[model samples]
Target: FVHYIAKEMTALPVGARVRIEGLVKAKEHNAKRGTVSRASAPEGRVGVKLDDGGAVLAVRPENLERIDDGRGGTRGKGGEGSNQAGESSSLPPPKKKPSSLEPKQRTLKRDNAILREFDGSPDPNLLVLYYHFRDNAFDCFNSSEYHAQMIRYYESGLSVRLVVPRKIGNNDYFLVGLRHSREDKNALCEVAFNCKRSFSGISMLVKQRCFVCHRAGAPHCSGGCRCACYCPGGCEERGRTDHGRLCRLVRESDVTVEEECMQLL
Candidate 1:
């Protein structure tokens, strides 16, 4: 029934197995200061600092009984590896395996609903579902859960991309910094818009055409009658009354259309 403070513990429930390899002594006192501070106190205070800059108070010595001194001999009155009376075991429960059709059946049911929402013509290749669990850093690129999810998706014969961007600047949204180039930005927007349309039952074709037209630098101009001509770089420049004529000139001339599109001029 021995217990000691561990520095690695964080948000763990009580009665969890915490390994500490050291001796326990009486709590130290600070003689120089009038009032003793926990940080300035010694190790015997039964407190530990976590990795996330947090501290946890350990179980009191009265509730703990030392079985081993971390050396060859036993420091307590009892011999090594002896537990006190009524001390419960700290071992975790054994894990069980899922049935062969358990996971696949669950996924199939969810996919059926997704397909029904898409009028039964949904592209299975474009579908991706993620189930994340608590207890890990989202900032790291290669966490154990992340890698395991990737492997599961890959083994299912699906072509998918898993993106977990770290918090940067003051933006709360992810991928704000990764989409620096116009092409990259457009790709992200297209994915987001398509996902929205698929889930909300909205028409994305009109939106897609509008995006293309905007990129081409042509105003709506009452449907098909565009006021601006088709330019290679799209609708970038503004405030010109004769945008149509300017677009025609750019199209006919050899001046490389740069400055806006992701490709070279």
Candidate 2:
């Protein structure tokens, strides 16, 4: 944001002790110039001490150019004695910092959209497609047909169902499914995680009430699989089919989420 003024540039190297300029009759007038007192001058010039005068004088790079190096050579713009024989090497480039704000903001926007479109469906498949579309904007979901398909799925409410996998650190989590009726072929609503519960093994604590009925009670785990939790009173029975499929996947997964984050396509 600060613009450096090129007109104020000075050739003298600041902080170097140097002899005063001029004074042809002075004893050190022909001697090597003293070190420059400072790099910058008050009036947009460089500060240097004369060999004989020893007083600071504001001068431009051109003024110092007249100073002989005693070997019939002149001082360079950078400074006197900068290079032994006018040979110089460029400095190393500066380092750049990588930024993560752009991607994070994009993810935040996508999450907000998901929460808005969510209709209490436990399906994770639709979410996968949604994220896929977002990450790969050039992919299939952006098309009119795909958009319609996604809209339809979002509007399906409790009828549509899909399984999703989430990796948190080294642990993997699947959304808990719930069924409310014996005739229900799949779970409709996802069980919410209890944030207050103690975190054990990348644990996602189940909501105190049933994921389906919202009943107030302790939850029951289905088939010993940690992925599905329900009310033993009856919600567990309704989710048996849908939750069974998820449980089977979790059982068969040879790699734990703790090992690596997987893209569940």
Candidate 3:
């Protein structure tokens, strides 16, 4: 019984509001209400970011129970305090419909990115290419996982659809200087390839360069597509041949790229 309790971790989705239940070692936080801030984790533990203090707790599922959320929505858990800790509730079964943030919606985007994969055709340097992946851990975003996804992007070479969010570790972290140059991939023998990983996404992309004339740092971008670069007069005119066709297609794709963080000013 003790061993069973030791390894049991409930599969609560992230953002599921919970009330801390039974705990021995850390009894100070008992009865506190918090949301299941992290539903996905490497340690198979739950991360509850408290509403009162805002400190995230790594507790077992047995210690957290889904609550009424107080916002009309059960957060997909159940109604009015749902089940007791570790005991299935008699409350109406939790909603089955997936939320927008769920993996289902994101799978389509990832699929489209794969189908429309492009490696900048004539010259890889000029045009912009967005890297994408399905699953991501918090540390992996900046650490080894970042590189792995970059390599995956290089191999797949998708340019149409943008990447979507995955589970980040239990923190509000930021990854800068994310270039598409190189990053670490999953190691067979747990390899060590620690080099700076370059990132280029919708939020922060490399400087635009003239796609047609092969010139660095171009002034104009194809209005509709917004990926291809062009110089002022002659260069823009020169690249028109290739950019013309791509411009129409990208506009037709209608894929909107969103920035990760909002501008303060």
TM-score leader: 3
Clashes of 3: 9
Please give the CA lDDT of all the candidate structures: 0.23, 0.34, 0.40
Candidate 2 residue spans exceeding 4 A from truth: 1-211, 215-220, 255-265
User: Which tens-of-lDDT digit does each residue in 139-161 have in candidate 2?
Assistant: 11212333244334334431122
TM-score leaderboard ranking:
3, 2, 1
**Deviating ranges (above 4 Å) for candidate 1:** 1-92, 99-265
Candidate 2 — worst ten consecutive residues by lDDT sum?
A: 192-201
Q: Could you tell me every candidate's TM-score relative to the true structure?
A: 0.16, 0.25, 0.33
Candidate 3 matches the true fold with a TM-score of 0.33
Model 3 residue 115 lDDT score: 14
* Model 1, position 56: C-alpha lDDT score: 48
- Could you tell me the TM-score of candidate 2? 0.25
The TM-score between candidate 1 and the true structure equals 0.16
Using lDDT as the measure, name the better of candidate 1 and candidate 3. Answer: 3
Candidate 3: tens digits of C-alpha lDDT, residues 21-87: 5465777898798877677555666888888878988876645555554532233344234554434
Greater TM-score among 2 and 3 belongs to 3
Cα lDDT, model 2, residue 249: 44
